[model samples]
Target: MELNSDQIKEILPHRYPFLLVDRITACEPGKYADGRKCVSVNEMQFCGHFPQQAVMPGVLVLEALAQTGAVALLTEEENKGKLVFFGGVKQARFRKQIVPGDVIELHTEIIARKGPVGFGKATATVDGKIAVSAELSFAIAEPESRN
Candidate 1:
């Protein structure tokens, strides 16, 4: 199924400035998710990351991948309303630079699961070229009450 930003918010806990996935193009609960992120020059990171030559940070790219994977995990009936935290990242590779105006294609597949932990193979591409790829680990847990 496809999901817009609003619908994505219902599944992801992140909000403005942090919600990297702009739209979920495809999703299969407990299996995989494909999303997109439109990078802008006005983003906060660009302010300090490099004023002269702005570039999307590699770590944020990894986080985006993780968030994409989280969408797949959170949509499952058994995981709804839960939060997915980053357990670890493995085999992360930065293949190309992502710049403003670039629309990153995020894809993540849940390759394995053990209890509340899940392993995902993820990749971020721009214009059909890989910008980043990694094996991500996630730990699912209930969200803490605000009050």
Candidate 2:
């Protein structure tokens, strides 16, 4: 299903300047998700990343992938209102630099699930070429007030 920014905000906790994903193109509960982040010169990170030649950091790209996975997990009615926190990351690699004006496509697939924790394999691409890939794990946290 396609998700707009407002719908995405309902599923994710991140806000502007930190919310990396702009929208979700596709999603399958407990399975996989595809989303995109439009890198722009107005981003706060652009100022410090490099003044002359700003490049989106590799870590941020990975975070974007993770956020996509979180949206996949949290959009389910059973997981709503829970916070998805990064547990770990493995075999992360950056194949190319992502700069302003690039549209990054993130594809994530679930690899494993155990109670409140889940694992996923994600890839970020630009123009059909991979820019980053990684195996990531996360855990769901229910805020104290919700419990």
Candidate 3:
């Protein structure tokens, strides 16, 4: 399924300046999803994250990819209303710097699911070349609790 920004908002709790995944191009429940995040110079983070050479932070790239995974995981009836939080990140690598005007294609595939915890591998690509990749784990948390 393709999800626009509004639908993405419905699936994710993040707001502007923080909401990374701009749109979901494809999604398959319990399997994988493809999304895009258009990086712009006007983003709030760009003002301070090195003005001379603004690079999209690697952490936000992971977060963007993870958010795509969260959308895939949370869209299910059983996972709705639950907040997916980062549990762990392993084997993270940044191959290239992502700068303004770059459109990052995020791909995430679920590796395993045990109760409220899930594991997946996510990658960020530009022009079909990998910019960053990581193995990520997430846990579903109640809306009111921080864990």
Let me know the TM-score candidate 1 reaches against the reference structure: 0.98
Candidates, ranked, TM-score: 1, 2, 3
The lDDT of each candidate is 0.95, 0.92, 0.92
Off by over 4 Å in 1: none
lDDT of 2 by residue, 39-75 (tens): 9999999899998999999989989999999988887
- Candidate 3, superposed: residue stretches over 4 Å from native: 145-147
Q: What value of lDDT does candidate 1 attain over all alpha carbons?
A: 0.95
lDDT of 3 by residue, 8-81 (tens): 99978999878999999999976888999999999988998989999999999999988999988988778888
Q: Write the per-residue lDDT of candidate 1 for residues 1-147, one digit (tens) a residue.
A: 899999999999899899999999999999999999999999999999888999999999998999999999999998999999999999999999999999999999999999999999999999999989999999999999888
Candidate 2 residue 146 Cα shift, in angstroms, is 9.9
How many clashing pairs in candidate 3?
0
Which is superior by lDDT, 1 or 2?
1
Models 1 onward score TM values of: 0.98, 0.96, 0.95
